[model samples]
Target chain A: MARELTHGASADSVGTRPRVAAQPFLRRNVPILALIGLLVVSGVYFSLASDTFLTLGNFLNIVRQSAPALILAVSMTMVMTTRGIDLSVGSLTAMVGGVGAVLMRDGWSVWAAIVVMCAIGVVAGSVNGFFVAYQGIPAFIVTLAGFTAFRGIALILTEGFSIPMRDERFVWLGQGTIRNVPVPVVIALVFGIIGWLVFNKTPFGMRLVAVGSNPEATRRSGVNTAALLLRVYVISGLAAAVAAIVIAARLGAGSSNAGLGLELEVITGVVLGGTSLFGGIGTMTGSLLGVFLIAMIANGLILLRLDPFYVPVVQGRFSWARCGCTPMWRVSATLRRDSF
Target chain B: MVTPEEHEDGGSVPGLDTPEPDDFVLQASDLTKSFGSVAALRGATLELRAGEVLGVVGDNGAGKSTLIKTLSGVVAPDRGTIFFAGELVHFSSPRAARSLGIETVYQDLALCEHLTVARNLYLGRELTRHGLPWLDDRRMARSAEQFLERLGIVAVPGDAVVRNLSGGQRQAVAVAKAVAFSPRVLILDEPTAALGVREVEQVLDLVRRVRADGVGVILITHRMQDLFEVCDRLLIMYEGTDIARLTTKNTTLEEIVYYIDGGSGREHQRAGSITSAS
Candidate 1:
C-alpha cells in the first residue's frame, strides 16, 4: 500500500507510527521478494555444489517431487491467512491416501475412490471447522487434536500396512507428463492460479484477508465471519485429501504414514515465503516460491552426498527461521510505518 | 428512497413538538436495556432530525454507548420504539438498522487498515462484475475517489492502505464508507476522540458537511468544544437518561455543565431522583 517511500505522506501526527525508516518495497513485500532472492541464491549455491543441480532435468524433477507438498501449501496459505492453522493436514493426507489405496487395492474404480476420498476430506475439514468455529474452541487446540486423532484413524484403517495402487490411469495422474510437464505439477499450477485468484480478485478473497486482519471489525461489517472461517478450513482439508491421492499414486502405494511431518513442510514453505505468522498477510506466489526453495535445498543437499537426514536438519532450521523473520518483519515494518 | 422535499411536505406524521424546527429522521423513544442487575439505558429518549447534527454528550458510563447501540440495533432495547422516516421499525440487528439507512461509525471499528482505501470503502458492500465473485476493483477505486472528492478529502489516495493514512484521513475514509451507502441517518461515536488538532478539525468539518447533505447525524461525543463547533442540538445525559435537551444556538456551555452536573430543571421530579452527580 505504501509502495513509494519517497512519496510517503506521513504529512502529520495522528496515531502512533513506528519510529524507523525502511525501503518501501522491502517494507511492504519483504516475504515475496526475500523468497525470490532466496530461491535464486539457493539455486546458484546448489548448482555450484553439484554440477547436475542446475540442469533442467533436475529442476523439473524437484517440481515433480514437490507437487503434493506445493499443492497442500496453497491450502495452508489460505488457512494461515485467517490466522488459523490446520495441523491435521498431514494426518488427513495419510488417512485419505490409505483409504484410497485400500479402496483401489480392493478393486474399486479409481474415479469412485477419488470421490469417496473427497467426501472424507470434506467431513474431516467440517469437523475441524465445527469445533473451531461453532463450538468456540481455539483453532490451535482443535487442529492439534486433529493432528493426533486423525493419524490414529489412519493407522487403524490401514493397520499400519501400505496398500499398493495398480491403477495405470490413477498413477498417470501423478507421475505422467503433460506436454513435457508433470501432471501433478500442472495440477499444482492450477491450484496456485485458483488460489491466487481467490485471494486477490474475488470478494471472498477480500473477506478472507479482512477476517484475518481484524475479525471483530469484519464481523461488525455484517459479514458471516464464522461461515467464512469454517469454509477456509474445509478448503484446507479438501486440498490435503486431493494431495493424498497424488502422493499415493506417485509412489504407487498408499501408506498409513504417507505424509508424516508434511504439515510442517507445507507450513515451512508458507512461512519461509514470508507469509506473516501473525495472520492477515500471505501470498500464494510467495508460498509457491518457498515450496520450490525448500525442494531445491533438500534435493541439492542429497545430490551433494550429504546424509538424507541433513534435509530435515536444514528444513527444521528454515521453518524456525520464520520465528526469526517475525521479529525482523516487526522491526522493519515498524521502521516502514515511521518512515513516512 | 423518500426525498428530502417529500419529507418536508409532512410525510403523514407531523412533528410531535411545536415549531417543527426538527423534522425527525429517526426518533428513539423510551429505550431501555439492562445487563444483569446493571441498567445500561433507562428509558433514554433522543431524536435525530433530517439535515441536523444532534450531539449526545455525557461523562463515561452515562449510557451514551448503550443509547446509540440501541438506536443502531447493536443492542435490543428492552422497551422502546425506533421510528425511521416516520416508519416504525424493529432493528433486530445492526444490519437491519443499516438496511433502513441507519449507519453507525464506532471508534476505530469502521475501517480495516490492512485493506486498500477502495476495498475498505466497499468492504461489506462490494460491487461485482457479471454478478460473480470477481470484485469490480476499478469501479470501486473510481467511486472511492469520487466519494473522497465529494467529502473534500484530497490527502488520501484511493489505492493507499488505510494503515498508511493519517488519523484524519482514516476517519474521513470511514465516514466516506458510511456516506457511500447514501444513509439517511449516520451515528458517529466519539469521532474526534483520538485525533490531533488538525485531524479533529477535519472530522468536525466532515460532520458539518455530512449534515448539509441531508443526512441526520447523531454525534455522540463528550467534547464540549466539538458540541459547539458542529452540533445543531445538544442532548446531555446524566445517570441513565436525558438530563437536558438544548439547542446549540440558544444554549451556553455553562448551562450544559449545570445539567451535566445534574441540576433540577423543568423535569424536576425525575431529575431530582438522582441525588449524587457521580
Candidate 2:
C-alpha cells in the first residue's frame, strides 16, 4: 500500500503538473481575469446600449480623459501598498500646476517650469512623508492637513483664480500626441512601467512589501523601515506632480480646483485594482486595470445616457460592494477591529 | 547510589574523562532580570556546549521563557554576563544577537505565513544577485531546498506558502531558517509541543541534525519523555531558580519531577513555616 501510495503520488504529480505550476499564476492573475471580464461585459453592454459607444474616437476620448487619473492611480498604488494614503495628492497637483503656470508666465522657460513644478510636488510629498514617517502621525490626519493647507497655498499662488501659460512648448506636452498616442497616455504608461519594475524587481520593492506586511518584522530583519515609508510618499508626490503638469497643459490654465476630488478617483482606481488598502498586497498591473475599469464604467455610463448625479452613487456603491470582497479591505478591517 | 560529588567527578574518578569545561559555546552567569518590582528571573545560570542538546524544563511562569528571552536579546538582563564562543558580549536587541550567530526559533515561529517557504528562509538576509541588489529568487529557492533536504524535511514544496505547511513542517522551516544563519547557539521554545508522534520524531531528527552540525541547542520543554529521549544535560527551573541540574543518563524521571514540584523538603518547610506565621 505504501509503494502504491508513492507510485500513485508520483503519477498524480506528473499528471497534475499544471495544478502546481498554476498556483502563482492563479494568485497573480485573479485581478487580471476580473479586469478582462469586466471590460468584456461592459464593452458588450455599452455597444448594445448605444450606437456611438464602441467607436474608436470615443475610446480614444476615454483614454484622453482617464489619462490624468490613471497616472495618479499609479502613484496611489505605491503609497497604498505601503499601507499609506495621500489625500493631499489633489492639492499637490493644483499647487504644482499653479506654481508652474505662474513661473512660465513670469518668463521662465517651459522645461525649467516643468522641473520647478515637479520639485514643488516632491517637496510637498516629502513634507507629508516627513510628518507621517518621522513625526509618527497618522497618514490620514497628515494628508488631511495637507489637503486644506496645500490648496490654500495653491489659491494664494494663483490669487484664487486660474493662471494661464501661453507658451506653446508647455501646452504641447499636455495636448500633443506622438505616433497617435496622447502624450499624457504615453507618460502614464512610462510611469506604469517604471512603477512595475520598482515594485517587483528591486530590493526596495521587497523591503516596501516587507514593511507593509509587518513593520516590526521588517525592523527586526535589520531593514530601515522608516526610510522605505518615506520613499513611497515621495514617489506618490512625484506622481501627483506629473499628473498636475498634464492636467494644467491640457486645460491651458491652472486653477485651485484643477485637480479637486482626485484623491477619491485615484483611491477608487487603486481599490478597484485589488491593491489592498490595508497594505502589503498589490500590483502595478492591478492598479492600471483598476484605472481603466473606472474609466470604462464612467464612459459606459455616459454613453448609456445615465444622469451624471447618479454616476457617483453607482460608482460609490460599487466601491462599497468591493470592500467586502477584496482581501486587503477584509484584512485591514480585521486588523482595525483586533487592534482596537 | 552515587553521591552528588561522585556524580560530578565520576567521569574523571575512574572510568570517564570529565567533559572539558571549555567545550561550552555559550554560558550565562548569575543572570538577573526584573520588570519594575516583579522579578522575572533571579540568579539564573545555564551553559550550552558545542554539539550538545540541553533541555530546560519548567512549569508555567517558572522563568524558562524569560531566560531564553534574555539569551536571545529580546530582553536585557539587569545583571548577568553572557559569554558567546568565549567572548563577553551584551546584545541590546534580537538583531544584534542574530548578527553574532545566535538565533532563536520563537514559539509563534516568527514567520510570515503569507510568504513561501523559500521566502521565509531568506526573509531577513536574502540572497542577492551579483552586480544587482535584487533578490535572487532562484538561488534562494535552491538553497532552501538543499537546507530542507539536509534536515530530512520532505513533502514541502519550495514555493509552497508557509500557511499551507503542517505544524511540523513550519517548525522544520523555522529551525532551517535559524540554522541557515549558521548560529553557534540555537534556542528552540517548545518545538515539538504541538506535534503528533510522527511529527515529533521528525522534529527530533532535525534537532539531532542541527547538533551534528556543531550548533549548541537549548531545548525548552515541559515533556519529560522528550528530555530523556534527546537531551544530554537537563536543567530544571522552579520558582525562578535553577534548582537541579542532572544528566539524562544519570537521573530518573521521579527525581526530576520531585524537584520540579518544589520537592517537599527543607526549602518547602521554611516557606510553609513563614506562610503559616504570616
iRMS of every model, one decimal?
Answer: 10.0, 11.5
A1-340: candidate 1 lDDT, tens digit per residue:
1011111223332223222221356567866766676678777888888889988888889988888889888888888888888899999999999889888888899899999999999999999998877887888899999999988988998899887898899999888999998888888889889999998899888988887888877766666778888999999889988899889889888888888989988888888886766788878888888888888889999999999977788867766654565677678766655655
lDDT for model 2, please.
Answer: 0.75
lDDT of 2 by residue, B1-278 (tens): 11223323221112222445565688887898898887889899887877777889877888898899889887899998899878898987777888877888877677665567777777667667765767677666555665566555444556766655666677777777777766788899987766678878777776766676777889987666777777777888888778778777777776676677665665655555434433
TM-score of each: 0.86, 0.80
Scored by DockQ, the top model is: 1
Query: Fnat of candidate 2, please?
Result: 0.14
RMSD of each: 6.3, 7.6
Q: In candidate 1, how many Å is residue A143 off?
A: 1.0
